[model samples]
Target: MKRILLACSSGMSTSLLVTKMQAYARSIGDEAEIWAVGQDKAKEGLKSADVVLIGPQMSFLKEELQKEAEPLQITVDVIDMMAYGMADGKRAYEQALSLMENK
Candidate 1:
């Protein structure tokens, strides 16, 4: 199973997105472990993730997060603002899968 970690300024909003991602994954029969954490816990979350997606509000941390993730052979990306704002989990989930595939 793929482990996808999502980080945002606070865990609350991302928790909603996690639910959507989970629903989308189930709909397509994609097995994945999806979770969300506040930016403060992002590093800890990264330890177990196959990929990391930072919420738009936290996008500025992408470079720093990527540096931490690279050595662990994890792909890191910023979730698209439009998709995130609209709570489009399918798009976000697809984005994560695409990043994993290209890696």
Candidate 2:
């Protein structure tokens, strides 16, 4: 199963997005482990993540996070602002899948 990690300033808003992404994954019969964590805990989560998506609020950390993830062969990206604000799970899931596919 693919492991997708979403990181935000506090993990609260991303938690809601996680639910939507999880539902979208289930609807399509995609076997993925999706979860959210605060930026402070992202490093620990990155150890097991296949893809790392930073929330728009934390997008500033993308470069740093990518550096940490690269050695692990993990794809890292910042969630699109509109998609994240609207809680568009399908889009978020697709974005994650696309990154992984291209990697």
Largest TM-score belongs to which candidate? Answer: 2
lDDT of 2: 0.93
RMSD of each: 0.7, 0.6
lDDT string for model 2 (59-83, tens) is 7899999999999999889998877
- Candidate 2 regions off by >4 Å? none
Per-residue lDDT, model 2, residue 7, is 96
lDDT of candidates 1 onward, in order: 0.91, 0.93
The prediction achieving the highest lDDT against the true structure is: 2
What clash pairs does model 2 have?
A: none
